[model samples]
Target: MTVRAGREFLAIPGPTTMPDEVLQAMHRPALDIYSREMVELTETLLAELSKLFATKGQSYIYIANGHGAWEATLSNVLSRGDKVLVLESGRFAIGWGSAATAMGADVEVLKGDWRRAIRPAEVEARLRQDKDHKIKAILAVQVDTASGVFNDIEAIGKVIKECGHPALFMVDTVASLGCMPFEMDKWGIDVAMSGSQKGLMTPPGLGFVAASDRAREVHKTANMRTPYWDWTEREGPEHYRKYAGTAPVHLLFALRQAVNMLLAEGLENAFLRHRLLAEAVRRAVAVWAEGQVLGFNVAEAHERSNTVTTVVMNGNDPVSLHRYCKEKCGVVLGVGIGDLQGQAFRIAHMGHVNAPMILGTLSVIEVALKALDIPHGKGGAEAAIEWLGESVGA
Candidate 1:
């Protein structure tokens, strides 16, 4: 076995590689939480974050993960017996339902297969069935990381509008934030949640929520209110009181820098880059799956996520190939989570990922597949090469 060395590439869906600019920005010594510089930095971040989310609504930053954001959003808008509709495409949707259930809310799950996205027609059907309109909120993830499925949030939003349902549209964009084209305000999304790990190109430490005035009003009248997760106190006059205590100084530093880098590249350019990068991976996998090797978990091309590609190994053990690619070739691929465990692998092309990095990952996977006697087509790598032939800086 030949040992490979250099930079060990970490290509998982979240906790993506941080840009040099963000790292450098975070390297400096911590500042006083109430310092003028800190205040300015925080203000800048909050203002710019709203733009990044494509929301003109209010934004709040928290020192937690994506799960924490879920809890905060649920607690803020729900009363004890409020009915919430969870649109399920994969694991994350179910997780949201469970969280709402635990919070003493009745959750109605509109289930879907892992291979496809949530159907707008199904959402309409459910809304139509709720003649009394008991559903208070519609919870969903724009991109489900587990199955690599991208739902049509815009179309679903349109359905909700047509139904005239009085439900808040809450979206989890932890995986899709900066990597995909998400227009929270344009799509009529009431509340949008995200984490710093995936698309912000930062180390994981922060969770963000962008809420509309209506959501804020609902939060003001919510049950089981806690001082910490309360959005009103967080947005009050005493800015330091928002965090409830001392802030995560270094993480804030990283976030400020990360958001800056994203803005520098521009959101439109970011979306285009993510789309092209994802297509390159899809081209490789589609051609490879032709010979009965590896195929995408999401069946439809339009429904697949631009952030990550979940690949099913048919009857083959994907774990073995994943290990070979990591230990032998220095590429760390993501293992399948939830139901697809041991049967599939994921390739993340979101946030700070480029053509050379993608090509490097693909080359190693092809070599490992052949070494393991895995049945696959010969030109998967070539296909990706041709896709990038035009340009990567596109």
Candidate 2:
């Protein structure tokens, strides 16, 4: 006997809950890929992509995912043996560096732990050590979902400029783009890459990359350029070249609606909403952590990301709690991956999330703890409610 009949709440990081408006927009007949309507749609989305990324640089749409955008950025400005410095705060940047390695570029990792954000001073030190500027590019992620860490892209970019380093500063905004503030041009980001599945509130499939004029100038001599991921090929006169082949018409429809909703809400308001919801989750988790078994994965309080919260489950198996939440309460939480796997569980408050969705997830988590006999402080959900009440006002 359980009450898990309603629609299951998805609290995972990426591939977040799609809005009904976006779904409705996709429920339509296919359009001619060569027609004027299709060209207008493509042009509108391309211009909007640059706006979302906060850049004056040219943006390209790709028929791929975040991983494919990684390759596109690397192949555009880097050569066969170009040295790339990966500022590792968590799994994704290291994974991006690994992709560079596979593509025949030499990769060096500025080692960092999952418990904290990347230190800007350490990045400056590393850049200063590269006397001859062997490193062609620096890679980082605005947010890493696995560790639930948010890196300071602006600070890192500033340090790169301070050191007078010529390496291109590339960022992966896959998990933080629409949920927070990211100024690609103002922050000195030479190349930026993102996906539709996270903060953008769209389904998985489309990838985007914005390149600065400096990066584009370097692209002329890049040795790793291939026809498919080549930036030049995508900037052709034909509409088909924008996507390398046939366009993803349905996904584009969904994305356009999603972006429209984001703009309507305003980016600053969306950031505040994500911040408030994330703080509510943190409040509940703080109460639960009184049991000593449940705690935050990030050591510093400020380092905790507004998009997702990683809870460290010590001495207790997170899988049991996850099972109870799904089977009995119809709420799905994000399972930790990479280095934090088996040791943590994440609560995502990004994308199409509101106060009730976050509060419900927190309530179900509290129920799961009680049902599983896991040691946790009582009134975790009530704490979340109290926080939202005080912060959100009336």
Candidate 3:
């Protein structure tokens, strides 16, 4: 008999598990979109978002997803036929490059192994080859959710500065923003974008972009901007300018609560919490990989992400295993994306997640492995518990 009946656990990389407070915050009547209270709230949220991005620059909120943020960044900073150098460490970088191409930008890619982070040396060499500084922007992601690899945006920014490249540096932190440490100004990021669903502990439908003054100057000269996605238009004194239309009332309420939670925990402490939980997950995975059929998709130890862990499976379809965990064990894991499809699965240890939640997810995965007779090493759960014992002690 199935005893796994209760609140379903979501271990997916994004649209992560939301807290009750965030949900309750959104459960109310729509506020007057132009009222004094709502106006003050909109202002406060925008200002707080700048702090979340670790920038003194302006942040624009869109009634869209990460894709909208990508388009918005491109439209406001790059004109048609402008050359952009995209560094592809995994699927998302290439996807961003494709979006640039769709906007009529000339795209050049520096490819890296999907199993490792992009190398600074490679990025520097590529920039040095651009004698005339033909590249307009360098686009990359802080973490590729697909491969569970973490790229060093700071190191890459240093490489760009050292090479004296004038190209704008754009980083996507959709999967790593609130869960990890990011400094937009210190890292020399001209523009950074993320979504609401991942580390912010809010539901999907909001896109955010934090742009530096240098990026704004580029926007003034950019010829491809639209009436809706224009940053300057969105940053006016009027409250309606924030959305270019009526605001997403409930999302704002939810985001208010979510940001409050992050600030309350302290960004550094939140990051440390994620690190501990992620380490616990890795410990469990390491024990399971002792049988050699299960291993990390990312090859390098240091390159792995603190937000999500991708497990590479041999001789088993991960999709079927994922189904078993969700349907039978009441645990929903992320299906492998892009090229890793069917061969790997991801466990997200981010956003409002704690030790009990992570331990429960791991226990269910172990159960699924045993029921499916997958050849994984033993003591996975025990290892996780022991690590948590020493790390986040009783």
Candidate 4:
């Protein structure tokens, strides 16, 4: 017998739980593709996106996901055989670099482990060594979900400047954008890309890129440019060119509502909410870690991201815990991927999540551990509640 009948909770990163208002906003009739309303919608979204990214640069919307945005950013600024420095904190940035390799850009990875954030000193040393400035661009992710590591983007940017490296500093904010503080211009990010799914509280399919003047200048001679992902083409006079084809009307509507909600909450408040919820989850995990089987994937406490927490299941298969949570308790957690596959599970507390949602997810996890006879510290869920009580106040 299972008590799994309910609106199943999704505690996975990306494609997170959607707010009722956002879903209601999408339940509308389609708009005329050529109408003034459509043009205004595109304009407003671009402006709002730039605001969200904290960049004064021009923002572009694409009919794609995070991976597509990777290509768009690459093709817009670098040429064939352009050396790209990939600072690997986890899987996503390496994946972004691999995409560059497939596109003919020479990729070099500054090797980093999954358990820790990227070291700024290593990045500076690498950049200083590139005397010829052969590296055209630097790729990094503000947060890597697979390893649950949060790279210090601001620190890396400062290092790049200190080394006088001319390579464009591009960042992937897919997992951290709305959930954390990311000052694009202030952080010296030349090009930054994110998806609508994770922190933005929208469904997948829309990718956003904000480009600084420096990146746009490089676009002029970028041989990797193609018509579909071309920044110039997207900036054409026609409204249709904004997306390169028919617009994703419903997704735009969903995004607009989601952005509006975020703006209403204020980005700072949203960040705090994510932090509190993430910490509550962490508190529970800390208690469970005493079992000797459950532990955090990220070794450093400070490096843990506010978006998702990856729990490593030592000497145990996470699949059983994952299945027990979903099938018995109606809570779906994120399964491990990349190198950590089968060794970990993730608890996501980003976007549209509140104290109860996080607390409920933790409670279900504790229940699953108990039901599955997995050894864990008692009162894991109570520990989460105590944290919320102390931190959130009455």
Which portions of model 4 show Cα errors greater than 4 Å?
A: none
Evaluate residue 175 in candidate 2 and report its C-alpha lDDT on the 0 to 100 scale.
Answer: 91
User: Candidate 1: lDDT of 295?
Assistant: 91
| TM-score against truth, every candidate | 0.98, 0.99, 0.98, 0.99
Q: What is the C-alpha RMSD of each candidate to the true structure, in Å?
A: 1.2, 0.8, 0.9, 0.7
How do the residues 1-394 of candidate 3 rate in per-residue lDDT, one tens digit apiece?
5546999999998899999999999999999888999998988998999999999999989998999999989999999999999998889989999999998999999978889999999999998999999999999999999999999999999999999999999999999999999999999999999999999999999999999999999999998899899998987888898899999999999999999999999999999999999999999999999988899999888999999999989667887788888888789999888989888999999898999999999999999889888888899988998987888654
Those runs of model 1 whose alpha carbons end farther than 4 Å from true positions after fitting are 391-394
For residues 1-394, what per-residue lDDT tens digits would candidate 1 score against the true structure?
Answer: 7556888887789889888888888898989888888788778888888988898898888888999888888888899999999999999988988999998999889978999999999999999999998999999999999999999999999999999998999999999998888899999999999999999988887889999988988887899567888887787776687677788889888888888778888889999999988999999999889878689999999999999999999988888888898899898999999999988999999998998899889888899888998999888888999988865645
- Alpha-carbon shift of residue 106 in model 4 (angstroms): 0.5
Local accuracy by lDDT, each model: 0.89, 0.93, 0.93, 0.94
Model 4 alpha-carbon miss at residue 340, Å: 0.5
TM-score attained by model 1: 0.98
Clash pairs of candidate 3? none
lDDT of model 2 at residue 314?
A: 85
What's the count of clashing pairs in each model shown?
0, 0, 0, 0
